[model samples]
Target: MGKTAPPSIVVVGSGLAGFGVLRELRRLSPDAKLTMVTLENGHFYSKPALSTALAKGNTSETLVTSSAEKMIAQLKLDARIGREAESIDRAGKALCTTGGPIPYDRLILAMGAAAYRPAIEGDAAHRAISVNQLDHYAYFREQLPDQARVLIMGSGLVGTEFANDLITNHYQVVVVDILTLPLAQLVPPAVGESVRDALASEGVEWHLDRKVVAINYVGDRAGYVATLDDGSNIEADLVLSAVGLRPNVALAQEAGIDIGIGIKVNQYGQTSDPDVYAIGDCAEYQHGISAYVTPIMAAARGIAQSALGTPTEIRFPPLAVQVKTTLLPVNLLPPARNCVGEWHSVESDVDGDKHLFIDDRGFVRGYVLTRQKTEQRVEMDTKVGELA
Candidate 1:
């Protein structure tokens, strides 16, 4: 009898989830032919660090914890870095890439999300940068000048964090958002107000409930003039578009795989094609698109097992999403999908505030903690219950 060939497994994307899956899969099935196709250099770095790197005075070199060469050798992977996965030939069981087609018995799509930049009219609008990756962060850092005036285009987690970081570094920071308050999507109005006040005290100029309609370069000042919808002009050296992220699903959609806000996946992270799986920010699970770190890390083992012939069911515990702004630390565990509830203040003190989401039946569905109160996340997690 001839020796049977080892199973071939290919992973797309080199972000946390992709790299994590490879680590687990290699441990579970040592002889499985593992290959990775990524658009990045495949280096390992902290995604959260991008927001505060400037405040901490950390460069790209310090941010990168591991090199591509080290990760490839450590995992024994055939890493095709800098190669884009153009499409997936589902029927052929191969991934078509810039480097060429690679056959696989199982494929994992962890392409992640792209930084979304909305259209703002002006010739210099293209000067705005969206820091979604390491190279983008590097370029942003390089362009920053001493006492630079920055116009931040959103007040979401990334935008606020960056604003805080820049302000801490003595840069003139201005944040413009259509939303009424900072972290409106993540916390209650009161919490958002508190954060707003904190950052404002640190000299962050907030232009809430407004949009930058246009931008034009001012060569004399070495800056750009951003005109708001209200006809107000703000001079800025740089503009950062941190509006949000749209999940990467074009390749999956082109392959005729299911896609919602992101690539749809089942309990085991299996896509429409049973042999193909997706995890991380690109994957839309039954709950929703989980872009946070904890849930992504928790899904890695189960996903790896299911991909390598096991039928392990994937389940997630109540997860907390923390906003990494040192100015006003926030920890939130959101309510279940479509759960009817309202945020009720638990305690408000000079140090911080604590609030909980109480459903109609009086069950604690979710909760929010800030500043000193954020230390009680474990206690809050235990209190997270759902509506009947």
Candidate 2:
């Protein structure tokens, strides 16, 4: 009898989830023929640096510690960097690319989300950018001059972080959003207000209840004049479209895979088709949400074990999404649904305080903290763990 050939696995995208699956798969099945494909050069690093760049005065190159070549050598896996997957032929079990088709027994899509930009008329709108990837951050950093005016279109987590960073970098920062409060949709109202105040004290401007209707170039200069719906206008050196993100689910949808807000997957990160799995921002898993990194990290081991044939049952816990911002001296952990609660604020010296949320049942489902009040994080974590 001939020796059975090892399984062949192909992973698309080189972000956290894709690389994570690749590493986990390698550990689970050493002999599996693995290949990774990415549209961008698969330089690996912690992506949270996108927001932290301004404070560090670091460019993308400074944040990216390893190149695709180095990752390939280190991980000992076949790599196809800077190549886009044109389509997937599931019947043929092959991925069609601009280069050629590559066959695989199993495929994983880790392609993340594209920044969402609302339809609005504007001149020099081409100057608007979303710093989602390292490349994008590098490009924007190079384009910025000292004391440049930056107008961000969202007051969400990403927008707030950028606002904090730009302030630290001495850039005049303005945040515009339809929501009356920054981070309203994420953190509770009180916590959101405190964060807004902190950023304001740092010289960040907030234009709540306003929207940009049009953007036009300011003469020949690399600038844009934004016309607000309120008949007010602001000229800015750059516009960052950080409103939100839409998952990359076109490939999965076209391949006849079930997709909702993202690629629908089971508890183990298995898609409708057992052989074709999804992870990261592209995957809507058992819990029905796929945005942050914590849940994705929790799903990695289960996905890997299943792909390698030594299947393991993994139950995912409700992971807390931590927002990294300098202005807000706190962390927020909200429940899954739009569950409401009353907040209790206790002052902790001058720099810190804890905001605890108690629901109708007197259960603490969420929490917000300042630097000094962060000591209760462990207590909140315990409650969250019990709830999970």
Best model number under TM-score: 1
Candidate 2 lDDT trough over 10 residues, lowest sum = 313-322
Instruction: Write candidate 1's Cα lDDT for 38-126 as tens digits.
Output: 98889999888899998777998889999999999989999999999998898899999999999999999888899987888989998
Best by lDDT: 1
Model 1 off-target regions past 4 Å? 1-4, 220-222, 385-388
Give the per-residue lDDT of model 2 (tens digit) for 44-124.
Answer: 877777987878867788788888888898778888887888888989999887779989998989998888878889656
TM-score of each: 0.97, 0.94
Error of 2 at 378 (Å): 3.2
Clashing pairs in 2: 122-215, 123-215, 123-216, 329-370, 330-369
Off by over 4 Å in 2: 220-222, 338-351
